[model samples]
Target: MWSWVLHRITGVAIFFFLLVHILDTALVRVSPEAYNAVIGTYQTPIMGLGEVALVGAIVFHAFNGLRIILIDFWSKGTKYQKVMFYVVIALWVITMLGFTPRHLINVFSH
Candidate 1:
């Protein structure tokens, strides 16, 4: 139940992130200075934290997608759905734990 809700939420968040990413990248072709100005804002500590959230969302979404695929394809998938959900969560936590500190250091050191 919660997994379904979170998967949908993360998917929407990722979609919006991609939309913004595309628009920002396109800015370079339209005007280099404007693109640079936009990118400069991303260097802030706040944006750095946003990047952490983005990575967390992506990791969770990806792992949860794989869990969904297993649920659909494996014969015993339904039987172990709850366990698989936990595995997805564990993987997401480990990944974020590894990423957040290094990212914060780089963000703050700059």
Candidate 2:
């Protein structure tokens, strides 16, 4: 189903971001110069777009994952899977539109 496919895709995307984030933090322990260099690369336009995509993926995966948890834990939630699906979609759209441009500008301006 579409939902299963999307959930897997978003989950993978979030995991990838988490890996990069951990690696970036690890660079601080390696050397401040190395960490700064890595940080500097984030200012580029391409990385800025990546940041936007990362945010969208995290938001979507987190919200939908929570919905899945509710369905598993609550009897009433199972009855509303369709409604929750729409809620997840709307939340994703709102978050992407609301955050992406601001984040892109901040990343690029730095």
Residue 68 in candidate 2, Cα distance off native in Å: 0.3
Tens digits of per-residue lDDT for model 2 on 3-104? Answer: 678889989888888899999999999999999999998778898787787787788888899889989998999899889989999999998889977887
Residue-wise lDDT of candidate 1 within 48-77, one digit each (tens)? Answer: 999999999999999999999999999999
**What are the per-model C-alpha RMSD values against the true structure?**
0.6, 1.5
* True-vs-predicted CA distance for residue 40, candidate 2, Å: 0.8
Ten-residue region with minimum lDDT total, candidate 2: 101-110
How does candidate 2 score on lDDT? Answer: 0.87
lDDT of 2 at 1: 59
lDDT of 1 at 12: 100
Which residue pairs in candidate 1 collide?
A: none
Residue 47 accuracy (lDDT) in model 1: 99
What is the lDDT, from 0 to 100, of the residue 59 in candidate 2? 88
lDDT of every model, 2 decimals: 0.97, 0.87
TM-score of model number 2:
0.89
Model 2, backbone clash pairs (residues 3+ apart or across chains), number: 0
Q: What is the lDDT of residue 34 in candidate 1?
A: 99
